[model samples]
Target: MLIDAHCHLDFPDFDADREAVIERARVAGVVRFVVPGTTRERWPTVLALGERDDVSVCLGLHPYFMETHRDADTEALARALDAHPDVVAVGECGIDARFAETLGAQWSLFDAQLRLAKERELPVVIHCVRANDQLAKRLRQLALPAGGLIHAFAGSPEQARKFLDLGFVVGLGGAATHERAKRLQRAVKSLPDDGYVLETDSPDMPLAGHRGERNEPARVAEVCRVVAALRGQAVERVAEASTTTATRLFGG
Candidate 1:
């Protein structure tokens, strides 16, 4: 079975037919999901999804929503993690250079969550965009005990190696499936057996043919097929490797 290592199933986009979406994913051989909380207000919804045997949850403040996050959210995240032992990670948090205005606050929030992950010995699910080198530098300094995932990773092969060397695994999603994504495809081709995991980043990053439509966990099967082709390996091999890596990183 394949695991969708990162997906925002808690988002309102799935509110209409959440069960049907998960059922479709199961039918497609995608059996597990990791749903992350982007804000303090969403933690309960995210945790509720985690009650399912096949779903795991992560809580953190997303950089993209920096304007909504308050100073107390980090402390609240700590309490939430303490209250929910089943929580597998501490993020959906990281730096996004696109929001230049909030860069400084993003770092502070990201660092707080990283420290929480370290103290709790839990993996983190990061959302990095155009800040890989800077994020990698901070990761090096912290050397978190429980290495995390660089969710929806769109970095170079060398950058992928840097994260892997730091005990973190890269996440491959629909973005890597595009024909013109040569750089990302090259990164996929260069990954080691345990260096990456599969994700859909549903309701956001639609796959190549499904552009302009909502993405869902069911499409992870296609991601596996494309990644296999990129790495010149069998689809089942990609599925097994990605599932194994995800299970190890976030637990079953």
Candidate 2:
């Protein structure tokens, strides 16, 4: 089964037809999805969706919305994990140095989640950005539980190798679909088959042809198609490998 390791189905953007969206994605051969929590406010919604057969959930404090997090939120997330068996991982967490001025709270919240994951023994799904250096350094300092994937990874080959060596997979998606993303494409090409996974970060990072449109979980197939072509393999092989990698990371 194809698994979108990262998506935001709980977001209000899909309120009108979220079920229909999942149905269409299933019909399009996208069998499963992982929705990561952005804040305490969204955890209930994500946990509810994870009760469904096709959904897996991760409780986290997303860096972009770190301003919304509070101390209680972290404690609440910890208490909520055992409520469901499909609560697979503990993130959608990490740093986003693209806007470093607003990053202090984000780092604290991210570190909190990492500490929780370590204590809980859950893998993480990080959201790293231009702050690879700092992110990598902090990760080494904290030494996360079992490592995690860097969602929508856009980095140099050296950075790519560093994360892989540390036991993380490189998530490839829309960013590598554009021709102008030369460095990202190179990273994707150089990454080993066992070290790469597929994701859409849907309703956010749309592919090349569908730019400006709502990216959905179904778009993961196109990403598979593109990345497979880049790696000189068939789509099915890419699908199988990515499916296995995601299952290994997030548990399906």
- What TM-score do all the candidates reach, one by one? 0.99, 0.95
Give the per-residue lDDT digits (tens) of candidate 1, residues 213-247: 99999999999999999999999999999999999
CA deviation > 4 Å runs, candidate 1:
none
- Model 2 TM-score relative to the real fold: 0.95
What is the per-residue lDDT of model 2 for residues 1-252, given as tens digits with 9 covering 90 to 100? 578878899999999999888888887789889899888888889988988888889988888886677778888877887665568888778898877777887888888889888887788889998888777777788777688888999998889888888888888989999999999888888988789889989789989989789999988988999999988998999999999998888865
* lDDT values, one for every candidate: 0.94, 0.86
Candidate 2 has an lDDT of 0.86
> What are the per-model numbers of colliding residue pairs?
0, 1
Which one wins on lDDT? 1
Off by over 4 Å in 2: none
